[model samples]
Target chain A: MPAIIELRDVTKTYKLGDETLNAVDGISLSIQTGDFVAITGASGSGKTTLANIIGGLDRPTGGSVMVDGNDLSKLRDRKLSDYRNQHIGFVFQSFNLQGTQTALENVTLPLVFARVKSKARKQRATECLQAVGLGDRLKHKPSQLSGGQRQRVAIARALAVKPNIIIADEPTGNLDSQHGDEIIKLLRDLNKQGITLIIITHDMNIARQAGRIVQVRDGKVRA
Target chain B: MRLVDYISLALRNITRRKLRSALTIFAIVIGATSVTIMLTIVFSAKGFINDQFEQNGTFQQVQVSPQTDINWGNGSGQNCNSSDCVKLTQALINKLAKLPHVIGIARQTQPYNFDGLFYGSKKLKLNQVVAYDANGIIDNHMLAGRDITQSDGNGVLTITSDYADGLGFKNNYQALIGKTVKLHTQGYYSGVGSDPVGRQQYMQTHCQNMGPGQNCELPSVQITGKVVGIADANGLTNSSGYTVRVPLSWARGMEENQDYGPARTSGDYCRNMPGPCMPPNVLTVTDELALNGYSSLIVKVDNATNAAAVAQNIRGTFKIGAADAETAIKQQLSVFNIVGIILGGLGGIALIVAAVGVINTMVMSILERTREIGVMRAVGARRSAISRLFTFEASLLGMAGGILGVLIGYGLTLIGNPILNHQLKGNNIGSSNILSLPIWLVITVIAGTTVIGMLAGLYPARKAAKLDPVEALHYE
Candidate 1:
């Protein structure tokens, strides 16, 4: 199968006052379709920065980031948005579900921005929430649901757009061990269904569940 | 995304903060209402003034007086010979009448009193003594009685129904036509040796002064004439305050003989008695004679199509000055416009304050929805789209406010009319209380409010649009 995401010497730099720091320095990596890859590192290990670059939320300072055959490094702001919408989805550490919207509405938000018709967007959002084991919580707001349920809603939102890749940054950071395990299993099942997944984490045990593990320290990837 | 989706989203967001939204909408409503009501008042005032001008006569009418100085107290100050004054003259009248667009010409003389009707010791005041040669042009549709004619110039008196009623006569025109009445003449009885109080001391000093049987002066011969016609007075009154109409010839005779009252000029009376005080050519039109002087001359155009051209021609012919009705109306309208602008400006200030409130609320909303914004950006919303959503929300608030304002304004106008009518009734001034709102003004207000609302959204919308998705998502 073809590599759905390719990173070639992708260097992301951050300005720290007068000096520049390399968050993702000259990292070359690839993940094939249906692969579950884990990028594990301590704090300041550039794992989250790499995830941001791969997800098309941030541009690389140098070199290329190609996902689904489009170079994200060269994409303009508008094209980057389009790329993210069609090819990559994000699940944040805080389970960034809009508290004001119901679980179904939160999931449907992506499709709404994509200009999907109301009925189709609602139907697809409902299906995605159900698939995430949130079938009974579709009408409940994020504040009304548990942390695990909110995380599930966020995952459902990311999957609702039917993107090829899911990029999660510490997806289970705030959940209890049991809920965290459930979220990990959800990602593993999605990967088993042929969707590529990339997760950034500091937990060695969580990283061990992935098919491939890449360790990073001081902005460099180690085998 | 589609407009419907955007609107729905905006509406939902507004609904989420219902109190904030309602407050913003309320501000807009007050602003719009004040603007509409102020404009309506200005419009009504302008209409009322124009109506008054029209009722008086056309604005084109101008009265010219040769330079002289006299204080008639609310009267003309022109002094010229009667002939020179009359030189506004048949020739001038005919020339003006024959002008291409001139419609009609008529002349008027001051009021005169003929005879007194004494009904058992009470004397009622008469109304008018108007004399017009072309009575048809003078508007003779009286509430009662017929108009005087050329024959009535010979001592005939036309009494109004009120006058007849006052005199104990049957309040019918025909019944009072040939009825006899006593005549009384009052004037300064000054002669070569006549005393000032001869009339008052008549019984006491009559025998001593007249050497038995010869009266000092035959109590100024009181002449009685049959009421040949009971005519419509057209609101003109004789000196006694009775609504009266006499023939033009009779009026002229009264003018020449000093029969009306005191002679306006001692020189005029002296000039007629064989030794002229001044040159005959230097005839003086006294302030009293000029009391009936027209302040302006109204020249009506024959063809409405030719109104402008005729007005221009008259201006050129008179070489004095000219003002067309349209120009006059525009001048009147400009006052309203100025008043409207001032009021609109005041309303604009209010809207600005409301806009600031809108901006603050939107900014606060953006702060609250940081993560949501980031989520939208991640989902494919461009910065511009985010900005557009917020801006759209702001505009909707303004529109809601504007609509409510218009309603409130109309309601105010509805309530104001009765109050205005009641006040005017107390003063006996006739007026209509309906508020006049032109279609263009309504459209302007709506468009203006929308634009203001949109402008108010711009800054906040830009701030919302420029937010970085990654940073925003990290915001707590």
Candidate 2:
């Protein structure tokens, strides 16, 4: 299959006092369409930064990031945000759901930014929740849900826009072993349905389940 | 995003912090209400005064005073015997009549010798007894009967409603019309209608017995006249506050000074005869009206626009004071304007303080919603959209306050008008509901508050829009 995302010598630096740290170092990688890839690293090893650059959430200091034929490095904020909305969905490990809103409302957030009508947004959010086995939990707020259920709700929110790629940054870091396995199974099922999935994790068991594993250390990647 | 979505979202945000939004709006309401009420009063009073002048035809008439520095609406003209004092005489009136835009002239005078007016023993102090040419140049708001016309001669007059009230007529002014009223002169009065023969006999009998430089008391004369009209005391533009008007003919007669004097033939006869011969007594009449000229002349112009020009012409040609009411009205209205500015400025200060409240509230809201803004931006909301949303929310606060304030102001007018009307009626003024709020005022107040809100929102909205999404999303 053709490559859906390509990065060439990507670098992201942060200034801390007088010391410049390269959070994302000069590294090149490619991921194909419908590919299930896992990026494994120790803490502070820049795996999350790589995921963010791929999702268009943060810009690299020097790099050409090509996603589905669009050069993200050259895009302005408006187009970059549009790329994130239309093509990429992010799932945080903390299940970053609005504690004040219902699961369905949280899912509708992306669709609202996409300018979907309210009725259609609701319908699509319901379908996404149902796909995540959370159809009956649509009206439940994050505080009312279990940790596993809240993660599933976050996944449903990420799935609402029907994006081309899903970036899961330590998707199961906060869950117990059983809940963590359920979340990984849900993401693997979604990957099987032809959505390219990238999981950032330190767990070797989760990384071994992916079709490909890229282990990152000291801001460099080794496949 | 659609405008509806933006508004809905903004409304939801505002509702989230209901107490803060309401408090902010309350401050604006106070400012708007004060501005509304103050401006309404000033504008309405200005409108009322203009309406009064328009009804009286004062705008079309130019008053010519003998004094060079005379102002319109003042009846005190120059009554000097000096040659420098320009007398408003018949010759000047004729020359003024020939001036461009001159339509007609009404000579005005006040008889100063009257002490009281008697209606069936109910004596009332005469404040002013005025006479003017019944040439339709002067208008009176008659309560009953008709104004003194050109045909009205001696013994015909019009008394104001205050006189009627003192005469026990009060609201029944019609009953006083056509009734005989006596005007009593002062003790030393020797004007028209005095008994010169009686005065001479009294002097002959009393003066001989009194020592030199001793004074002899003269009985006051009572002149009778029929009330032709009862006018509103506060309705006359030139003469207000308890006035009584009489025909010019009667005033001419009243102003005559009658005196007892020796006949012209007696002087020669007494010179040729023995020393014991007495001079024949005769009565002489002096025309004081002709001697003093009319106090002031009201020259009517063909149009109100030409009144100023005619006044200028009269001032230039006759060297007398000719003032159009427009100038004086403008001068008077400027006082209202000054008062309006002062009052409106007070309201503006309140609004500015309220705007500060809005800014504080918005800045606080932005701080609280920083994470939400980041989430929205990540989901694809443009920076402009976020900025617009916050601005809309602020404007909504302003709009709500403006509407509420205007309603409260309208309610106050409703409550205030009746009391004002009662006071005006007590003062004999006929106008009512002088606290009107025009549509433009309502619109301006609302729009002004909305604009103020938008301005106050700009800073906070810009701050919100410029926040970094990555940093904000992880904000604690």
Candidate 3:
């Protein structure tokens, strides 16, 4: 199988009061199509930064990143935003569902940016919510929903545009162990259906469940 | 993203903070309503004045005077000697009549012999007694009966409504028509309709008893005429409030200077006659109309557009003062234009302050929605989309305020017009609804406010668009 994403010596740096920190440094990685990969590290060990660069949310400061044969480092903001809309879905640890919007509306956000027809966007959003076992709570707002249900709504939003790759950064950080296990099972189910997945976390138990695991420490990959 | 989506989202955001949005819109309402009222008044006043002149056909007529300098509406020149003033004589009128573009002419004169007009027991002081050729060049707004015509001979005249009202016919001016009115002249008057034989007998009987150089005044003369029309007393078309209009033929007779004495041929006959023979009485009249000429001449051009050129031609050819209404109208309208600007500037100040309020509100809105903006960006909203959403919101505020203001202004006009109409009706003006809001003014005000709001939103929208997505996502 061909590699869907490739990175050769990618680096990202930040300056804090004249002190330079390498958030991501000298990383070369590849993920095949239809693969579930996990990246695990300690807090502030650059795992999330690596995931962000791969998802086209942030550009590498140096070197190159290629996703599906397009150079992510060379793309402008308009094209990068289009790439994210069409190809990548991000799930945050805090769920990041708009508190004021209904579950269906929250799930329809990405498809709206994709410029889908309103009727079709609504229909697809309902289907996405149902796939994450949230069909009954389509009209419920985030404040009305439990923690597990809120995370399910976020996952449903990530699946709205039928993205080819899903990047979840600490997706279960705020959930109990049982709810967290349920969310991991849902992600694995999506992965089993041929969507490439990348999970970023500090949990050894969640990392051990992926098909492949990469350990990150001090902006470097451990052997 | 689609434009509809941007609008929907913007509307939603505005509804999120209803109190703030309402306050911002209230500020804009003050500005828009003031602007609407000022513009409507200025433009409507200009339209009303222009309509009055247009109805009278004043724009198509040129006034010629003896003096070199003359303003419109003051047709006659001040008294000047023959060396310095060009008299509006018959020969000059004939020549001016033949000038190119000259369609018609009306010779105008004012006879000051009459002091009062009497109807029954009521006597009203006359402001002026005017006579002009009954041509179509000059028009009078008549409230009752008919204007003086070319066939109207002596004893036929028209009185303004004020004269009729003073004659106990206030609301019923038509009753004054066909009623004979007496024009009482000043003492020592010897104009038309005077009794020369009675004056001669009185002087012979009365003067013998008077001391040398003592004053011997003649009795006042009374001329009678049947009222032909009742003119509106609104001072329109250059007519005075208490004016009385008569035929030019009657005025010609009234303006004559009459002399009465013994005939020259009778002197030989009387000397050859026996004792106690009487000298024959004879009268000699001086034609004052020919000597002094008419007071002014009104020349009607072929078209209103040709009025100015014809006036220029008359001024150059005859060296007399000639003026068209266009020049005076422009000068008068420019005053209105300046007033409009000052009033509009005051309204503009209000709008500017409203724009500041819009800016402050938008900046605050962007701050409150920072996390939402970050989430939108992550969901693939372009930076341009965010900017457009806020701009749409601001312009919507302006549009709503402008619409509401115009509606309120329209309501005010509805309430104001009837009162104004009553006042005009009392003055005998025929037209009403002089206050109006033209379609262009309405469109201009709404579009202007919307553009102002869009400009005010630019800076804050840019600030929102330049927000860093990653940092904004974590913003509390």
Candidate 4:
């Protein structure tokens, strides 16, 4: 199948008062449709920055990022936001769920911004939560859930809009081996269902589970 | 996002910090209440002044005062055309009667003495002895009997209930109707007019060596008039609740006799004597021989708007000074309005402090929700959506305050009306409720408060919108 995400020499810079810092520099890569790709790197190797750029949460200072033939660099702020809502999903290490909200409410938040009608949004969010094995915990707030359950809720939230690309940054960083394995397994199952998956991580074992691994060092993809 | 979603989200956030929001809203309520109360006072005061002017005949009448040659407290100041004063003389009274728009031309009497009218042995000491043209004065205050009509002469008069009661007609106060009260225009002296000895003595005691301009007091002609009406109101002597109105013709004729009586200039008194000053020629006065002048002229016009034009015409043609009743009423009303504005301005300051509270709360809310805003933006909310959220929240706060304040204001009016009217009764002001808040006022206050809320939220909303979403996501 054709590549779903393509990066050509994408770069990201940071201003430090006077000196400039390149967070992600001269990076080029591509992933085919439905592929499970792991972006492997040590600390300061720019894997997180690359994940952010792909998620449309951060803009690269240079080069083009094309997802399904739509160049993200050419999109305006409004269109870029729509691109994130329609094409990409993000799961962070912290499992960014609103602590005051129910699991179902947390799942439906993305859809709320997507302006979906209430009845349809609730149905879609409930289905997503059930897919992540938390259907019965729909009314349970994040504080009432275990760490693994909370991570599942967050994963449910990411999948609510049914985007084509899922970007997970250190998805299992805070989990124990058993919980981490469950989350990775769930992600792989989702990838198997024909959704392209990209995981940013330092773990060799987690990277080995993906169909392809792109290793990074000093802000560039290793040859 | 749908408007409902925005509102729901705002509600959730506001409800989360319940105490803070309530306190902020309370500040707004206090501010709104003060403004509401003050404006209501202005509105009511304006109404009261207008009512007072209306009752005083300021709406349809213009007062024309002849420029007093001596000019002490006379109106028209430098604007008074002295030559125009001559045209307002009694001769023009009939001429002015012909002006098509001139509804009525009446002149008040040089006040009749309170002791002049006698009911048998008792002196009629009702309110002021008031007399004016047509039946206008007593027409407004008739309790019994009937007003003195144009055909009524010096032989007819109106008395107040207090005067009727004084004559021991308490059980049948209307009994005074058709009763004749002996009228004496001046003090009584034993045999002054008919006895030569008494006349000589009276002239020596009262008229000897009078000043250059001061005329000798005339021997008043006594003409008894029938009691025609009982006045319900006595504005002049409110303390005694007494008044007596007579026909304007009768009063003017009497005033003319008093002012230019005994038919004499100084030369006619001392120079043209036949023998020993001919015992002062006890001048035989005739109505045609008397000089006719008026203290002031009351001109009723077709309508209030025409009063100014009539006054202007009178001023342009005559030396008499004129005052536009409509203009005077409006001037008096404006004074109260300015006072009310000052009061409202003070209340506005309180509202401003309340607005500050709203601003503080909104800023704090924006700070607390930085991360939530980031999440919304990430999920596809436009920057404008985030700003709109805070503005809507602030406006909600203002709306709550405004509604509560207006309710409180209305409650105060309900409670204050009787108390204020009671206080005003002692001062003789009309007992109308003095706190009117019309629909426009209510709408203005609500819209004003909401606009204030929007303004207070503006800075914080802008700050929230301008926040870097990526950085905001990492905020704790």
Model no. 3, DockQ: 0.52
- For residue B425, give model 4's deviation from the true position in Å: 3.5
By the DockQ metric, which is better: model 2 or model 4?
A: 2
Give all candidate RMSDs, comma-separated: 9.8, 5.7, 6.9, 8.0
- How well does candidate 4 score on lDDT at residue A211? 90
Write candidate 2's Cα lDDT for B209-314 as tens digits: 8887887777788989999899887677677556778888888888887888677678687888876988878888888878878888889999999988888988
On lDDT, the stronger of 2 and 4 is 2
Which scores greater on TM-score, model 3 or model 4?
3
- The residue pairs that clash in candidate 4, if any, are B81-B319, B83-B319, B84-B318, B84-B319, B84-B320, B85-B319, B85-B320, B127-B242
Model 4: how far residue B234 lies from native, Å = 15
Q: Report the C-alpha lDDT of model 4 over B287-329, residue by residue, as the tens digit.
A: 3112435556677888887888887776666655667756665
- How do the residues A1-223 of candidate 4 rate in per-residue lDDT, one tens digit apiece? 8988899999999999999888888999988999999999998888888888888888899999998988888887788888888877888788877878999998898898789999999999999999999989999999999888989998898899998988888899989999999999999999989889999999999999999999988889999
Worst 10 residues of 1 chain B by lDDT: B67-76
Model 2 iRMS (Å) reads 1.3
Candidate 4 residue spans exceeding 4 A from truth: B47-58, B64-103, B108-131, B135-148, B151-297, B302-306, B309-322, B347-356, B429-431
Candidate 4 docking class = acceptable
Per-residue lDDT of candidate 2, residues A1-223 (tens digit): 9999999999999999999999889979999999999999999999988888898888889989999999998999889888888988888887778777899999998888798999999999999999999999888999999999999998988898999899998999999999999999999999999999999999999999999999888888975
- The TM-scores of all predictions, comma-separated, are 0.70, 0.79, 0.76, 0.73
Tens-digit lDDT string for candidate 1 (B1-476): 77888899999998999998999888888788778777787877777656644542444332222222111111122223444333234444566678776676445554333335554475654333456554343444344445666456556656555566676654565666666554443433221122334444553455445566664553553445456555332232211224555566655544442222233565655766774353322222233333334322334555545555665665566442334455556766787788888888888888888888788888898999988898899878877779889998998888888878877887777888898877754443435575766776676667667777788889989998889888888888
Interface RMSD of each: 1.1, 1.3, 0.9, 1.4
Q: 1 or 4: which has the higher lDDT? A: 4
Ranking by TM-score: 2, 3, 4, 1
Q: What does the lDDT read for residue B129 in candidate 2? A: 87
